[model samples]
Target: MRHGVQLLLVFLVLVLAVPASVSASSEGGHGGGDSKKKEKSEKKEKGDKKEAGKAENGVITIGPLVVNILSNKGYRFLRLEMIVECADNEAAERLVKADAKEELILMLSNKVADNLLANSGKMILRKELIDLFSKYTGPDKVKNLYFAEFVFQ
Candidate 1:
């Protein structure tokens, strides 16, 4: 009876060991295919992201702007460089060729003078300036505004 029990235990061990070894060998053989597939999918996804990011946002760059701000009868100043993002190719082209670009800058400068440089403007947030530009310039014309260079004095 004891010998029979020992033989049963050995049979169970063999059964478990055989399947585990077979599965490991199979996985090792096919592992290269799985890795290659994963790599291809990752590359495709990265390409898609690059295309989407480029197509949706077109960059428009302009010269730097330097302006003075007056707060509480003290002299405060801001020198800023800016870039505008346009929604599409046409808007980007218009932004490049449009005569109203200077006018838009003038309007933004006025907004800064009225809101930020005057009175208690030292506590103003940078978002306020971005909002001012966005408010004065229609959303159709400008997708987003970025301050590439900003200095406060």
Candidate 2:
């Protein structure tokens, strides 16, 4: 509470100081002298916003999910990571909030090492996982899926 009040006071001081400085600078023609600087600042701010927008629409990783799967010899370790391309950022966030990691763990645990290590098996697993996650992302909301990491031991 004390820190909050101090921060508020500092904010108020800065706010009150800015307009006074601006008015004084304009009166002295100093503000006009710094027009280019202001333009640069504005451009920098716009660039920052564009970067943020791209981040929102960027790739979202499901998990570096580590699970145990059944094998002919015994239980084996499976470490998998996936990224899903979504129709929109909101759909991507939904996939995360939908608790898909737990579902993936269960799905992976039922697999065998031989199937996972094989190309056909990996493709099948990818399709099944996509279909499972599509429940949360909505129909055709998932644009694509990519395996960032897949390790079976």
Candidate 3:
């Protein structure tokens, strides 16, 4: 009788302990996976904010036209701000006299200027733009373009 009682107690303890151990291990594994996903999402958010700041600072002026070109996957938009920089002060004076705002908007709306953006050939197109801009304005004047806000339907 004594031996049978001891054996039953041992069996009960083993069954309970095994399930507790399994549940603890499973919960820990799930927690680790969740943390990793959260970390990845946080990093992505930080990168996006940095890109936006860079885009905001990318404003440039040529003659009397202030230009902020946003390059997206398929298209680009030139946001005109205020006239600031020019090749020559006299050219700046002429542009200011000629109503540069209207001209800039018209040129952008009509797509008269080259897009300098490509869909199927992104890398090659980027390299081409860099090369072209460098020839005219030197490499230091040209940098990469980014789309701060993008919407696709």
Candidate 4:
């Protein structure tokens, strides 16, 4: 009778302990999963912010302008056909009216801006022109710039 009671007590203890252990392990796993989900959501939000920033940085457009400039070295002249993106449509129109190619050559020769490749140069020139135009307009109106077509000779 005593041995039977001892065996019953041991079984009861094991049953109780097993449920507590399982509950503790399940809670821990759930907590870890929740933390991982929170971290993933935070990372996704950061990625979204970066994408928004990039979108806000510039506007893209096509161009059919001929830019003729005398190079820094007096003997060489570069003629380029380029596609440009402006911070805004106003800037784009201004660029067209001012003849960006001519302005770029003058700006580069005068050291106001650096000479760059067809694509990069157009982007830089677009920004520079936006800044120039913003002086007459307002900076809040300007965003970013890009280039779609560029040809250099």
Candidate 2: tens digits of C-alpha lDDT, residues 1-153:
999999999999999999878875775565664676788899999876543213156357766778989999999998888878888887777766537766768878998898777789899988998898788878988888899999877
lDDT of 1: 0.57
Worst 10 residues of 1 by lDDT: 49-58
After superposition on all CA atoms, how large is the RMSD of candidate 3? Answer: 14.4
**How much lDDT does each candidate structure score?**
0.57, 0.79, 0.45, 0.51
**Ten contiguous residues minimizing lDDT sum, candidate 2:** 49-58
Estimate, for each residue in 26-102, the C-alpha lDDT of model 3 and write its tens digit. Answer: 75754565677689999999876533111233343333233444444444544433322323333333333334435
TM-score to true structure, per model = 0.39, 0.61, 0.24, 0.34
Residue-by-residue lDDT tens digits, candidate 4, 3-110: 999999999999989976676567575456567778999999987653311222234232344444455454333333333344655544444444553555565444
Give the Å error, residue 73, model 3.
24
By lDDT, the candidates rank as 2, 1, 4, 3
Model 3: residues >4 Å from true position, as ranges?
A: 1-32, 44-49, 55-106, 112-153
lDDT of 4 at 61: 38
Task: Identify the superior model by lDDT, candidate 1 or candidate 4.
Answer: 1
Q: What is the lDDT for 150 in model 1?
A: 62
TM-score of 3: 0.24
The positional error of residue 95 in candidate 1, measured at the CA in angstroms, is 3.7
RMSD of each: 12.7, 11.6, 14.4, 15.6
